[model samples]
Target: MNSFLAIIGRELRIGFADLHRVVTPISFFAVVLVLMPLGLGPSPQLLAKVAPGLVWVVALLAILISADRLFGDDMKEGSLPQLMTLSLALPWVVLAKMLAWWLMAMVPLAVIAPILGMMLGLSTEAAVITFLTLLIGGLGLCLVGGISAALTLSTGAGGALVALIALPLYVPILIFGSAAVEAASLGLAVKPYVLILLAFDFLAVPLAPVAAAAALRIAIDD
Candidate 1:
């Protein structure tokens, strides 16, 4: 629909309008990857073994950090209410914004994840698996993050609250995403875990926007 596309375009403009918004997460992701080698000692075997989980954890955290700003600024600036009044359905608008966020934020993170995995000593198969899982799982992260962002929209303390609300929900994606790579590393079939992840994505992609729309409406009324 024209409205959905317009909303997506608008969100992309807002997202890139400030370079820091995109840079902060990528920088944080890189910094976390860098710290693992330093903090965990110089054990390549150890790093390789933990790389899958570590990458997923860092990516999840980066997503959370960005989610805090997803709607907070709009709420503060009073544009959210106007958006809600638009001709397009609020859920569609929310979905468009989330889609834009995923393209702008998650894509870059996903792209670097494999390279970072290689730097951390992940096997070629593991790195490829990491990339595949992230491609699917990252959307789920955006969906959940959108819901959290909407829920805590106008709350004075959003950052910690968003993490607390989103982290628990993120566990399933983390588990399956890391498990897929671990299975690949062990020469086991990753299809089951990947399927599980796809199931979550199927559920999340539709449900999140509607839930976020409801949360945003409640936020505006309050």
Candidate 2:
């Protein structure tokens, strides 16, 4: 756990160093949530119908925003070069960083879920399920988005590349997460959806880091 925890703490401290950079994207998540009620004219019916997609969409974008910066510092400071030659497998290290990144970005999104839910006219049950979906699904985003960041670290257009690669990957989670809430709103069982999200977590959590480590090695290969 030494390098892993060290990476987590290092990544997290760097993540928050610039408070504006650290918090602004999440503010975007919240602002998008806040604006929906106004845009939809505050009709509870309208809000209910659109809330799930809106929340997932904004959450997706929030993950994308943070993904680009995940490896920026390491790349800039030549740490990635050193990392490539480290004895440890790179993916686990990258995964640890993703965990920290998720904590910084996605957890905030979850914390603000109720407020976002209310703005979208989410029913109590729908809101709870949506929050659960996000809580589970956001980990997958961090894993996948982390790999996207690692894959693009040397490209000089990390942000654009991250969005291009990761946004499409996020679609399934978005679809299911929103669909789960829709099912909940309709009084249907959300068990399948939750299970799907957990499955995603199981797959992405282990696999994405390995892929990210490989990508980092490739990107830094001289």
Candidate 3:
């Protein structure tokens, strides 16, 4: 427990050290959200119809933008291998890093999603649903992104490679998240979509770090 807290604190300090750069992904998320209504010609009905999908796509991309850095610094400083050697479980360490990443990268997007949804003509109910979905879906994004980030820790392509590796895995989460918001907007049952997302989150939250820890070990060994 102490190790987990320490890991998370260390990650948070590192993440916030470059606070301006750390917020770049959030800025991109905001730009995408703001641009969509302009690009789509300002039709309220049309914007509302597409708002859920647009938000999910932008949020996923924002996460991808930050994911590549999750392990890059540690690997570069040779601290990743040292972390791997710790008495604490490597998976927990990975999870701690991911949690810090999520807070830095996704929390801002989650916070702004409702405002963006409203701008896109989504109703109050839809906006709320969008916020919830974005928060949960963001976790899944970081989880899957952690694996890709670890896999590409030694690769030259960096962020592009992380996107390519993680994007396919993001599809199901995007579908379910968008569906949940769409359903809420239409006065349909949304619990099913949210449930699917929760089920995946529950599975991914624990399992992804384990897989990522293994991948990081391999990357370090190579």
Query: What's the lDDT of the predicted structure labeled candidate 3?
Result: 0.88
lDDT of 1 by residue, 1-222 (tens): 988898888888887788889888889999999889999988989998899999999999998888988888888898888888888888988899899889888889988999999999888888898988998999999999999999988676789999999999999999999999888888899999999999998999899999999999998998
Q: Give each prediction's root-mean-square deviation over alpha carbons.
A: 1.0, 1.5, 1.1
lDDT, candidates in the order shown: 0.90, 0.84, 0.88
Residue-wise C-alpha lDDT for candidate 3, range 1-222, written one tens digit per residue: 999989888887876787865788889988888988778897898998998899888889888887878888888888887887889989999999998888888878898999988988999999999889888888899899999999988774788889888989999999999999999999999999988999988999989999999988888888
**Colliding pairs, model 2:** none
lDDT of 3 at 64: 87
Q: Over the stretch 56-162, how does candidate 2's per-residue lDDT look in tens digits?
A: 88888977887887888788888877766777677767887889988888887887886678667888888888778888999998888988898888787888888
Backbone clashes, each candidate: 0, 0, 0
Worst 10 residues of 3 by lDDT: 13-22
Give the distance in Å from residue 61's predicted Cα in candidate 2 to where it truly belongs: 0.8
**What order do candidates take by TM-score, descending?**
1, 3, 2
Whole-model alpha-carbon lDDT for candidate 1:
0.90
Distance from true location, Cα of 136 in model 1, Å: 0.8
- How close to the true structure is residue 82 of candidate 2, measured as C-alpha lDDT? 79
